[model samples]
Target: MGSGTPSFLGLLCALLTLRPGSGFYLPGLAPVSFCPAGSSSSDCQVNIQLFVNRLDSIESVLPYEYDFFDFCKDDQEKRPSENLGQVLFGERIETSPYKFSFMKTETCAKVCTKSYDVSKQEERTKLEFLKKGMQLNYQHHWIVDNMPVTWCYTVEDNQKYCNPGFPIGCYVDGNGHPKDACVINVSFNEKNTFYVFNHVDITITYHSGEGEGWTGARLVARLYLLGVLKKVPFQYLWDYILVSMPHTNIQWFSIMNSLVIVLFLSGMVAMIMLRTLHKDIARYNQVDQEEAQEESGWKQVHGDVFRPPRNGMVLSVFLGQGAQIFIMTFITLFLACLGFLSPANRGALMTCAVVLWVLLGTPAGYVSARMYKTFGGEKWKTNVLLTALLCPGIIFADFFVMNLILWVEGSSAAIPFGTLVAVLALWFGISVPLTFVGAYFGFKKQAIEHPVRTNQIPRQIPEQSFFTKPLPGIIMGGILPFGCIFIQLFFILNSIWSHQMYYMFGFLFLVFIILVITCSEATVLLCYFHLCAEDYHWWWRSFLTSSFTAFYLLVYAVHYFFSKLQIIGAASTILYFGYTMIMVLIFFLFTGTIGFFACFWFVSKIYSVVKVD
Candidate 1:
């Protein structure tokens, strides 16, 4: 088996000849220009290189190196350096043997060939493995200009679907059923055989280097195979994909729908705060009506609502974790909206979030310590320790379990021991110490002052109605927030489970804000009702209320698994849910903390403004 010389294999089309010395920057995918490195722009000939990325299947969580399929190999293969996020994602990108010259155009070129005799066991085994890859429907991922080379085809209803990767091959089953790609030609009609794609006709579209605001030559590469001349993608989901005509209208409609819901919730919250609450405060503050007024409504619970919640230590820990997740999510989505984490910078989003979470230990510790102190707890050491270790420990443990599975399965998604050690070092060395520094400062500062003082004896709580019960209220609180993002969640799930590209960061950021408002208002609404009913245990209730959104997320995930996904085998199923639980936990903390702080502020403001004597 060896790479063959480039030879025409299909219909010839337009041939492009870029200037020999034209300089072009291709971010993350290949060279900065069509010239050798360190050469002046005018002094070099074209040096275009095509890179091959890891082959993956939607049927499995694992992705493999380009060389795993044994097609073509660079005589001296070179791999670009990968960042931590890329490594974790199993992005095994390497130089391909397919070479291009500036003045040349190749049509349907043969890249490599492998001839095998069934009598040779080693070659037979290799052939069998390649067939297995076809059976599993693994796709080849080619890249140019830091963008995936797209293979576009017409799906049902005459709509064009551009896939970022193309199938390695197609297989015809014993029953004479053919996979989608096998229908390209009658030559592939033989049953029980695997037909491989040995040739590709690549069309490269480019923005001239001299274009205004151009940092480099921007290129989009597409492969037109057989007679299927599908509409090519200008970029592999250029992040501008959603802003296209039809997509733009649908996305804006979704945004408007969500905005209406958010505005309605905000209006309700504002009405409660500005109108009803004002009347309640005014009537209560009447010179002689204080005592009677204090015996009813939310005002009655002021004395005990501020009391330390049960399981104060654990609650504080969760709050710390939530704070960390919230801040990390905010900054990540914000950066993505600013185009700093565009698809052009592969793996930058995860890297930025991880770095932000690691660096945000100070705020986590400060919030946890301050809250724990406000709860009147004296176990300062234990509080800080839990704040630093508890949530991260659980996540790491889950991740370790998942990694073990990946390791046993020989998946590249498995984290190498050295990388795991580096992560642990980041946690213990940087994050933990920052947590300690924050705790020290938090302890030195005064504990947060409550507007109203707690009585020496706890106030007797009244029985709650079904709707206002702890379980019911928490469960209900998650619904509205989840509603705000469920549409967005569908796109996110498609990106993860279905291998679709998702780059609508501005839309996501808007949904994030709406989710925040929904969570805050829903929790506040419930907290007020609970208080009015004279159930003063609001601390944990507020946290759990918003936290239950994660439960809804879990439910939706389960629904998606059954309805939307075609994943099979126990390992893939477990892997999917295992990863999902991690997401759910992080979301739980993020939302719960938002609700907790919002309710806390509401309680404080209401209590502070009225005379509590």
Candidate 2:
């Protein structure tokens, strides 16, 4: 057959499948049954009308087709029923006989009707008529901006049906319903609703067969509610289902705005290195005694510049921890993008990150021990212990305090005491021992050799510009790299606190790559300028330059809590920033390590490449 013939045949098949009454029930004619009080059978019937609100192009954020039906006996129990047959094809299903009552009218009037007498057909018919008399008033209201919503449920015993999955809310049927009967509810109010677009269904089809035999199909549902109307009062519906508003996308422009300042600094550094310092260095050696004495800028820091940095052991530990965090983050994001730690798997992402970091303690120990030895630190044992405990201890202490609050509050977000103990076991039991092993190997190796020899006395740094001073320069260096990532951070925070599903791994990975590039380039460029300025104390400064972004992140966290968040009480604030500090500390180490290594390479290469007689 010709290509056109195949295409035509496929279209015909699709049309047949999609046509009304072609295996799928018509929209409005779908039957909804209600069981009257004390009646074992469903004695009432009503039609449920499905309507779509405003439509928008951003359906990926909120997708739910109008015709997708949810099944449950009450407002507290909702479950997707459209594909129930497929989901339970081979499963032995069991349901208790419970009275299912439905009321279509806005309000019920007491008619003093006797308890449903199922034995009498006349009484059953009369009850059915009364139920049918209740009219369902369809508002057909359109919501433009969808409200954020959450699905809450509980699982008990070993029964299968008791566990209702995602996009479905859950509640305990406290009215003496079967213990295995899972309850669910969907709300659209600003406080407790899943934001679904009103009127859109998107389907994606793929030709899976190679050479004309492949076929694949996927369907997405969407609903849009107006942002303003979401707040309007509605009696029958819940006021709010979610605790907070759905998080907005990361403001890339705001991040870019901050980055512009860093770029400007980079340009300034470039100008000094290429134009001003190059000539000054060349001219300094050739000048006579008087002119040499007047030598300024970075030219003064030739001696004592490369002296082993103070607290080298601590610095090494910091770098090691940072390296561990960086690798963990990279792997976690990669796996998440690949769909390993998706929303379907609760706690998977954190579990993955923790496992990976614990296993990778070898690298942290190796890097710290090697750096410490190079810094002339002879206490390998101290280095290894510090590497394993110092930073992690600080984080754990903070975490324990936060956990205490969570335990008191009884929030599901709290880590159980057993889990906390397990984390400690992972750290001290697994990670600590691994660090010692790595340190043994690192110390056995020779110290890393520097390309340039250190002068006995430090060169005096010349008076510097306001922007080039240590604090200002270091602070400025972090902005560019942080700018590349703050937008991505917003989404991450939302996924954590707002409980939104974050599946856009592609965008996140791109942002991660951008952050690494920005950190490296910005640090290298600044290190070169400092070296040319004769201020060779680029060791800690280089690390701090990029790491300072963590400070800004902490500031933002504070601002978010005070301004954007409705979280109350000191405990919440303390818990929020305490956990935030752990994040910042890890981030500090990661970014600092990136800058250090980049500067380390730049310093070694530039000095080694140039003939230093």
Candidate 3:
């Protein structure tokens, strides 16, 4: 192990060195100033440029590029300083028409005017679309110095809410009800007409050098400007999530908690296999006449232990999908851990996952076909087709239904018809054929060899006690696995719902390894106990045992929704649970497959080793 350590480190360094930005770096900025377009004033050097991202509404899933809104365009090509994650997430930040100089105090200054002639048909159409986006509560995400320009407002209880994005403009209804943001100014009172916000009052605040040791000024405030077009830009954290936590406390806490659970379970399993099982094997090997009648435990049931399970076709299909998912997840997380899929690169994580899943159909098919054949299944075509279609079909149907809801609600989150077609093409055109190829190869391969001969008659399993019952054992099996992940799950949930940045892939990878270990050990320990109680039916039980962890995950998510989230609305609630169900199903298959294989190996090894006449 010691000799291999240096070689492993050298290889890791080489891989990371070959990949650009595959190592951690702190975010730093060099201050620059801007004066009037041609002015040479040294005091007014701080110039800020606005960048635009896709315009999205809460009611829809489709996001349009900045150009689609017909907003102010930049004169020159200047891209913002973005990280790998930001780029991969489709954040097309570029120079904008709006410019500002560093200001010491909060003073509203006019930035620019966006006058447009509505007489032209093209201009009118663009204006109408922009107004419709505002009517539907579409938000504009702006970035300055890599920080979100937040819109701050007072809500109920006099508490202030800071939204990372601001509205384009507001529309008042014919019935005299002014929109929410429009109520802030009397200038936006035109009924049944789109009031364009053509002017913005900019406010900037900065910390002077005297207080924070900065040589000049540091922008520290998020501000908003309102007009007939109000623009408010409030500065928020850029990369403090990665650097500024309470200093490794959360990571250590999560690690310690998982370690405690893992150590406890590992101790239990170790005691059972090393001490109890060793003695059991020794006593059974003696085979004295006095103990011959008492051989009704696990040793007596060895003849039927290797029997192929009922509904083996479905089980094999799940195992194949599980294997595919396992490989994909491992590679994805490994890339992330190595910083290749760092949060700096926009959309890379999802893109990588989708591409990997598409390319992995062969493994799924191969594993499913091989396992099905081993189970004495004769229907190769059905097995392969089901493996290709079943789980993916279910997830797609759910996603399509959700998309329909988004369409009806007019939310920007809905998938476009073109994108949907492309997805289907990828699945049917590429994935299905690859799965068939894998299945063909899998079917051609010989079935796996068993260690012992099977009995002609299936042995009758004795009635199991409470401790050894399937339900109880499976329920207990999930506890440790869930414990290992619940901490990391919190951060993941935060990143998705709370819009917090998640950049700790190293910690996440560690947790994944722990989850695998916990699931395997817990399942194996329970499988041994069940077999000792003479219950030879373990195929389904072993799979379901660790898969039950997903149930705990669902429960935790529900608790999180009510306890941690302040999200209101039936649509949001429905969307949350709908997506969560998909995650739960995938996790169920992944963890359950790990447990099943571990138990399979353990049972095979122990039974094969004992001397059976």
Which prediction has more favorable lDDT, 1 or 3? 1
Q: Estimate the TM-score for candidate 2.
A: 0.60
Best by lDDT: 1
Cα-based TM-score, every candidate: 0.90, 0.60, 0.73
> In candidate 1, how many Å is residue 304 off?
1.0
How do the residues 1-613 of candidate 3 rate in per-residue lDDT, one tens digit apiece?
0111111110000000001111123222343333333553564445665677666554433455666676756667477564433433335566776655544232343333344456677766665667666676666777665456656665677655555566666777887577756787776666675554444555544444445333544444434445444334333434333443332578779988998888988999899889989888898888874675577678887878888999999999999999889989999999888767764455668878878888999999999999899888999999999999999999999888877776676544566687678778989999899999999999999997767778999988787789899889989989889988998899898766655457778888888988998999999988988888989999999999999999999999999888887655677678778888889989998998899889989998888778776
lDDT of each: 0.76, 0.53, 0.72
What overall lDDT, based on C-alpha atoms, would model 1 receive against the true structure? 0.76
Local accuracy of candidate 1 as per-residue lDDT tens digits, 401-464: 9889888876767888998999999999999999998888888889999888888898788777
CA RMSD, predictions in order: 4.3, 16.5, 12.4
Top-down lDDT ranking: 1, 3, 2
Candidate 2 vs candidate 3: the lDDT winner is 3
The all-Cα superposition gives candidate 2 an RMSD in Å to the true structure of 16.5
Off by over 4 Å in 2: 1-303
lDDT of 2: 0.53
